[model samples]
Target: MSKMFWLSCCVVLATCFFQMPTISAGSRVHRVRRIVGGAPAQVPPADDPKVYLRFAGKAAQIKGVLDQPHYVFRGIRYGLKPSGKDRFQRPRQYFLEGDIDATLYPPPCLQTIPGDGRVIGSEDCLFLNVFTPDLPDGTEGLPVVIWIHGGGFRYGSASQYGVRNLVGKQLVIVPIQYRLGTLGFLSTGTPELPGNAALWDMALAVQWVRNYIGYFGGNPHRIVVMGQGSGASSALMVALSNIAKGSISAVVAMSGTAISNWAVENAPMITAREIAEYHGCPTTSAMILLKCLQNVNAEIIAEGDTILERTRLTNRGFVTGLNGMLGAAPNAEGRFDGRSLPAAIEQPPMDDMTQGNIPKIPILTGITRDETKRAVESQYQSEIIEKLKGIPNFMDQVLIKNLQNCTHINDAAKNGTKQSGGYFNLLNPLQFRNYLKIARNNFIQGLSKIAEATNDALFNLPAFLTADLWSKKGVESYLYRFDHISQNKNGFGHLFLRGLPIIGNNTAELNDTVSHGDDLAFIFEARNLDGSAMDPPPVLSEEDLKVCDEYTRIIAEFARTGKITIDKKPVEKFSGSNFIQIAKKPKANNNFRFCEMALWAGLADRLKSSTCQFLNALDTTVKSAENLFFDTVAPAQKNIGQGLADTQKAIGNTAQKINPLNLFNRKPATPKTKTN
Candidate 1:
């Protein structure tokens, strides 16, 4: 049968097994109590029918049960269909008509499967869901939070996320859907298609909310755009987009890297031609190419696995096909338009997109304690090692050499001498050293460069560069490193970081590797929504839960308000030790230092010194300003070496006159002042 028919059959079968409750005309309203800081308050019951929100000549019918005090609209459409001519273009304004069945979520976009066929989803997938306590008719403005889902830009849809629980917290949560894969990212570089269509989609969505969200009881001016992984990456893009400036007030990015090298180094026109040819169109003209692909069967286009596999097998040494398919991920060019937009991507050897000029808004950016380890072990470990086997000392020489090349650090010769000097050395010292040796023996000259390029492109450089950019923006940027590993070993407990034995050793050290998506369980209050407690491993005691609670509360408080410490005074002064650790027992300890952060900051400074001479000249001016030091410098320098602070002060001083519009323009240095 047809793909759509098969998909419908599968969805129907899946629904049958789950016995999902369907909304009827006469469902009773359920009342829930609101709890704050363990205190209970009365809440009204949900009692309204799903209503149609008409706007911009379109109608969006939302399904919701009105609980007294809040009319919660579950799912609503915010943008146009991803299918037909709209694919790969900026999202069009959605005009709603007829009664929309908002009670249930719409399907997600189509994606590639691993084997042969395609994963079935809908093309008309540009939709959004909103949850608010007050109905549009009665309530005034409420703070709005637009949540962007994380899936590495390849997977995830708005349907899976439910914000009913957050509605009671006195906020409106809007979960949005944007184009993914080729449809979202295909860039032609023409005025008609300037690339970054996914970002454009978000910008338009925010604009929509701004113009109409007030009717939905949301404050457009106070909207905070939040995201994780690819979603977080998209969030950063929206925050930096000139089209979206002043449209969003705050941002939250979890496990997102601002700049993507692949997007930067490669041109999208080349890939667009390939995709067009794949759809039987042989043309370089973007409009004609897009039209050709638009007419192709959606199923044929959905068969991206064929294209991805062919690209990988060819070993073209480029991230073109699948990467491009998953939306032309952001690069330096995608972020700027005549220097009006914030530079989301940071490239070394050039400080044009310096950290000093990012949007000054409240930000929450962090990485999991074992983020790298988890990333390496899960996705790259086997494939990476296998790919390097051809080279000598494949582990040490290849991996270490690769890291050094990307970071430009030349400390491989002194392996293990300074335990925490190089990123490769600190994260996986033994493996990196061994890899270096192997690469030297097996591979030809410049093998080290290859390894370093891959490593930096994938991990280290992106994280550090993003942090530097945000810190330089002069916002109240909170940095965190999650190190807690629960003790439980299986089931739902596996979500917690239970200390597991080292790969080859019987002994277990506290596994601090921030595994991918580990922070999601904590930061999102995911478990709490379904009435499930976020249980750490069984090894964690009641005290650990308390600690988790404190950490959770702190994060929630930060999300609601801008401060992490909140109304409660810090027992110790905020001497750059403002972070709270979520450990076996959550505690506010100033002694806890983020070693990775220190390393990253040092690297950022080194990069700045090598690339931007103007920043180095202004060091003294920034050092004397205590407010600038406290607000901008100290947080990044915490636990880092003194050189980091010195470099930052210099950069800050040099950047004092750097406007967001003319970041690359530098002024002549002033003579040094005499200190008698």
Candidate 2:
């Protein structure tokens, strides 16, 4: 092992005991002692004492242990407690009084369980963890990476993911915990309170990093904001918000898009009030509702597990809400005070420092092979069917309609069944298959309509359109698709006719498919208590490991430099063959072109076609080829084309009419014509 790796291991092992403060100059001799069953021995002088630094009128201490040659601070507070009246308000600068305990992690924000028995969460949770090799020498500043965790919009925490492995790479890493669900997302629109408090918290954290990371060896100007899921979504918000201009240098958004349907149309005040009423509040005023909610026990708030449960039943499964509404997400109202874009203009906002635009910087965006499969397996078969039982032909009609719209129904079906086995039965297959189809179709339809809408609201049009705009502005953009599948050798035969005779093929298939969050274990390089890599062990073989390593290296490299390519080759043609194939063997030319096109074009179309007046305002811009190209061509077109191609390939020779009940063949029916 290299000196760095050995040093990192020493730091992690010793962290359980003494806290190291600083490292001394020189090559020091060391002795080792064993603690765990067969693990390596601990080096003497486990940790340096905690060090204190004062800034922004607060005194905070940094606690870390020195491994071979590095020090790390686990959890540190960068802001004040945002509880009671402080809830939903912008985070205040954390003021430290005396020697603060910087060794242990702090509690995360309040959140609720989804009735799954897993701990839901809390709102008193604005804390950040920092890891550094060693304090910087004289004038050198270490590059920093700030990671945001993902959990849709309701659940997640930094504590769940550890970064010791990445820290060993020699970069300063900080994982931040922000308020989620009702506490962090609540908005009143009153002069006293604005929505998007969670976003503001992130902004505060960034500001904190800019001001404080230097003490621990981080460069304020070299910070990279990275996240997955909602964390990715929030990172996009920061990347697009005026508040983050000049603060963040680049961003890494995993499986997230910038503009969301939920965020643009829904105002926090409307949803926050609704949630309050659901919780037994009797007022419409946000402040009053918030005040009433403050007295309610955290457990009472957590009990709203019914909301998510019901959402699982609704035709539109898991509606993204303020806490749970379609139109509830962070938008201009919170930051821009509801100002409409320039009149008669067609382009979506692009400047990061202006209005709703976040700072323009290098970005890395990608999604998993079966992004929706986990969500489907988790709720579609059981929860959705139960909810739709009373609706007239809802499953059949909706399923077929959705299938027709899917860009890769057949491929998804084949892959789904291959990965899932018999789990992709006739009844359940339609749910997953149709969902993918309709999502793409709707996105396309929405973009077309937005192009025709009047030039006022262009919210949905901005996501793909912005990507195009950014490319024009000379910003580097890279996109990726993660198609890895986790399956046992015995599981493959069940997905094809060759293995249908198996008694429990369907059940066994579901067992093999790549469900959501399955990739997380690999991405985070998680390990079990026994020190073995987590279940669904790293998919790549040695050859593939080189690729995986390269992919990771590129990600880190991009974080350091604003480019995704190391050579002069166009990013579009630079396939990620160096990374291990998450499912199949790594191939040199397998780019995510079609998928990218579909997403960009479909999203633009969704924005155009939506009945939302705000989106309708962007019609003029969508009409012009230049505008459309600027908005959709680069990002969504490639993905869309790839998705369509994949879908066609999956359907194979099946000429069966699109039937929602048929799993692989279905599409959304046009709104029924009414007889005169």
Residues 240-275, model 2: lDDT tens digits:
666667888988766555543323323345455445
Give the number of the best model, judged by TM-score.
1
| Local distance difference test scores for all models | 0.49, 0.48
lDDT of 2: 0.48
The positional error of residue 595 in candidate 2, measured at the CA in angstroms, is 8.4
lDDT (10s digit) by residue, model 1, range 452-529 = 334333343444445444555555666555556644322111232121101111122224343445555443434321
Best by lDDT: 1
TM-score of 2: 0.62
Q: Cα RMSDs of all predictions?
A: 18.5, 16.7
Worst 10 residues of 2 by lDDT: 495-504
